[model samples]
Target: MSTSPHILLITPPLTQLNTPYPATAYIKGFLGGRGYTVTQADLGLELVLKLFSKEGLRRVFAEIEAGPYQLSDNARRMLRLKQSYLNTVEPVIRFLQNKDNTLASRICHSRFLPEASRFDNVADLETAFGTMGLSDQARHLATLYLEDLADLIKETVGPQFGFSRYAEKLAMSATTFDALHEALQAAPNLLDQMLLELADALMAKVQPDVVGFSVPFPGNLYGALRLAGRIKQISPATKTLMGGGYPNTELRTIQEPRFFDYIDFLTLDDGEGPWLRLLEAISCQLPVASCQNEQLADVVQNNLATGNRQLATHQLQRTFLRNALGEVEYHNSPQPDIPHAEVGTPDYSDLPLTEYLSVIEVLNPMHRLWSDGRWNKLTVAHGCYWKRCSFCDVTLDYISRYETAPSTLLVDRIEQIIAQTGQTGFHFVDEAAPPLALRDLAIELLKRRVTITWWGNIRFEKTFTPDLCRLLAASGCIAVSGGLEVASDRLLALMEKGVTIAQVARVTDGFTQAGIMVHAYLMYGFPTETAQETVDSLEVVRQLFAAGIVQSGYWHRFSMTAHSPVGKNPAKYQVAPVGPEPGPFAWNDLWHEDPTGTDHEAFGPGLAKALYNYLHGVALQEPLSFWFDFKTPRATVPRHLIQQALQEPGKPDAARPNNRLFWLGNTPELRYEAGKKGQQAVLTFFEQAEDFEVKVPAPLGPWLQTLLTSLASDYDTKVLLKDAAQSFPTAGGQKWEQFLLSAGWLTLREKGLLVL
Candidate 1:
């Protein structure tokens, strides 16, 4: 090989406005670790920055005025205020990038930012934010202001224009490649031209031998192919590839030869194995047939027949390539996927870490985390530990194959990421972060003094005790989200979610009590879900919100997918598949008619309305029927169900002796204070917000002070509960067990003492 092929990874337009999607960073890190020259770009962020600039607004206004198109009242209003938008666009963008903070009060005023139809939601804006945060309120207003320009663009130049997605409708549920192919074949629109120009400029600069597009969402699919087409035309020698969330699930059964015209290679599941093997083939400059031997094909066929994925690691993993005969060929290697520990820390070097815009679409505390700030995205582990959820694509490799890295390695990675990004906010993009691993990682972060604010998804398992939640919060975990899908116990059991409504209530309450906000992923319209069950589910959610157990939540409509258990065995769930039949391209997201379930479409709006009110702490006391126009069954759930569950005391600290004993507060300073017994020993804890002191007689105080020192997170040795109990010093015949019930111990417990 002349030289190891220079690889370029691009995150296509568009995904998030706040943070760069972790897919490319992850791939770049692993590949860079392997001694490859890998550079990366976030075209999504680039496009947003370009499209929202002063010059960009001028072009948009020009296009709208010149085009022969009918304008909505809002579009006309924005057109009338064109100069206002042009003047404020650049400053507003800079402000959103966190480069300007003095403009918040001005934007909060009536006339600072240009207003259009998007400003009509003034009532909801005021209600949602009140006067709590001046900057955040300004951000919300600026978001709407930008959205007004987006509306004008959609009406005049680019019909598919969106803040987070472009031409997404063409790719969503696109069972065939015809629509996407046709769009790519058509002349580029103003937006598409801008995307291509940006891609072309990057390609010219990098001049890479291979261009890899990370198509994480359906919206990204079109842009990836469009960019690939441009790269093929301008630099014919360069190879192209596609991977990430979209192809990992949707394009597994691809049979379209036209699809390969844009991308030479496409990978599924984790990219580590397939990418290494593909690079080997590219180094040899050989075709697909020359690369994959006959025995490898035999192994793939054999594995498929037997439903076995664990095989020899020498072959190319799940990949799609076009052969010399112009036919599609699929190759799945027998080798095991890379271990999670070996994937290396996600590198954010090539990405513009500071240029991303932090747009605020939602105002609530837990909800705004998604779109309001940059988060260093990392995965605690690979795959879901519990992959039995019927509605999920449990059969997919991304979920079925489970692996974990040690907490020490995870903390090392976390520290490395913080050093690279200079941002301490992390979003653990795990399917479900293991509780024990999080518990250990929390301890490691505390031990190393690596402070970061983080959040992640998890199953509401009973293992997340109040003490564990406290440990996580101390480690800077500000929020957590878990699926409380279809709150009916029967539906939960049917879906194999392994969590009941009562368990969710208890878990969410533990997080809330520990000062960590919780967001529940609510689901509706599970197979065989009756009207009564649906109404009852709403009641459970209401109770969760009313009791202040859950701070934020969302309702999701269930869609059976081809890889899910329900799609595989619809008879089991009593649902029938409605046919569009599998086409020559995309194949996930199966259409189904749940004959045994209620009219799910009818309940969607009502469920959404009720949730919208619940999110803002409004209309919570209203009757269930008040949310819907149609007569609905009364909720059968008891009013106190959630409260009762929250009140249920879990196992006490005395029951778990093997658990680690930790001191999160400051180290105590020992001194003598005047007392009845001449001079008693007093220990003072100088905490950040407040300071407190405890006094005890003579030897007991000195011994307790030494124990607290050893229990501090900075200490190397761990002190177990049983060992700590055994070492307790008795005073006035106060035994070890008696000391546990004393005010001194309880006060210490309240002041950051943790038995985890």
Candidate 2:
């Protein structure tokens, strides 16, 4: 018998996207390093793609027709135009998948495809009617077509049906296991049927000794449990396990036996340590089970009888396992927490790279980052550096703990990832990447001559100086998103955000000046936030856009969570608990009420509408009260607050140039050299800067090289050619300069060639 366990890592249904979530990738990499034969399957993306195919649509329409539920007008129309849908479904999917650009013109044509209720919005029509709008229209129509089918599935098959989430209604804020258990026992929907088929296919292909389900969100919970139950039913010998963000947060106090009926073990926090120990325990018992032809329970009992008390202990540190009596046993691994460097590079080899759909439901350019392209997700650190936010789950391990690998290690990982995945785009999925760590990483990336476009979340703090921002942009940073939540200094202080409005404006302005796009994560309705404060916060947000400091932003209403400081001590913030605490099954998003009696819920729609208009540059001068339907007290915020903050304290210097250069093209010619014997690489380049020519070892040299190579070029080629004679040293120099100028190596500036 093979001593090595065959582990199959599964991403459950409804979390489909252009790229797989990083959970399985991280787990796969960690386990693979330990010499385990691991395979991963993204049943989520597969299920959605399958359901949207021509044959799948036909089955859906047939199901809708045969079902007893009342059909919406859109559903009736889809049934009527079933033939057109069937004919266009695959082609539409191909177009959306970026497989066939030729289908775009066909799909854009109004008569080529059927439309439904999702196209009823006037904004969607406007987008469809805009210049070269056909592709956009086609994508929207395709999304609508899928949504119509999803609705049909939801109405007739399962009420919880969605493309990215299934049975979420039964999972979110589920205080008891009864709802989820009842959901599992209920009739299978179209989604459930498709997931079961996928589960069976995966099990047959891998024939694994262990199956691990990664449940990242509440929506993925039901599908994960359902899949695990099916796996246990068909292959009773397989050891089933569950872990991920949802389980780490929700299943902490697991009193429910029904959960164990599906999976034998539930690991928490970082899965690396617990998983290793669990595998070792299983491997030790496997031989006994094989010899006696006994079930896993007997083997477990035999191990316990033989004084394997460590594995038999119910209160183990990080792992919750099942014992001989079918009772859940919690065990803490004796192993220390794995270092960040040892987690290994996230392996994306098992995922279907090309088949994932890049859906574009919203035409907003900034929001497109979530769905537009595949980004290799990586973490700068193990957890958050600042887990002090009152509304945050600061007590949780994922937030409370903070550890980071060296900058050299980070770049090494990046290089490895690039070689493995053949992709240069990365998304840092950190809770909040520390500013100092980012600075060091940026310098290291430049020193090693590594090049990649990346973006991530950060805290809008004063550490991000203008010079630092410029350095980051020089190192291929395109965009940055950070929390500017609540935008009011008083509430910001109360929330312990550690940054004021004035500070945020300056920091964001620095990023904007450095040619990087800025996206702000705004919040409203924090405990004790007044109506006037809410109005004033919108003013700050508007001024941020008006000053062109922030390009994109989103606002979310705050909800208290159990692990937050506010939840633990509600009266300190003058808020009282409104509902009973969440029970054993799931416990995030607790209800609370402010004694101040501010109707925070009423401001949501207006704030969203105002933001929508603000993002599109439609309403800048509109009154804060104008967004709200009812009479709202005029915003008391000073109109010139942002403008005043932007003005520097000292007088402008006549000798120093105020203007900074910007890169024009999407790509530039540059090379990074790694110096020998622990020395930094020497960098050489040309562009607009204080110095035009220089050679030095990194970290400073590479930054200058990147900056010089990225200067803006928007002038006519003929003009640059004509001016080359005056700028060059000789006739031959002029000719060479002209060639370089024409090739975008140089550009004409009023002062001189802007290079350093």
What are the TM-scores, per candidate, against the unseen true structure? 0.94, 0.84
- Which lDDT value does model 2 have at 30? 92
Writing each residue's lDDT as its tens digit, candidate 1 over 188-242 gives 9888888888988998899998889998888898888989999999999898989
**Runs in model 1 with CA error above 4 Å?**
124-127, 130-132, 286-315, 671-682, 695-699, 713-715, 730-732
Question: Worst lDDT window (10 residues) for model 2?
Answer: 650-659
Give each model's whole-structure lDDT.
0.86, 0.76
- Return the top candidate by lDDT: 1
Residue 168 miss distance in model 1 (angstroms): 1.6
- What is the overall TM-score of model 2 with all chains considered together? 0.84
- Show model 2 residue runs off by greater than 4 Å: 122-138, 288-316, 324-327, 649-685, 688-756
Q: Score residue 161 of candidate 2 by CA lDDT.
A: 75
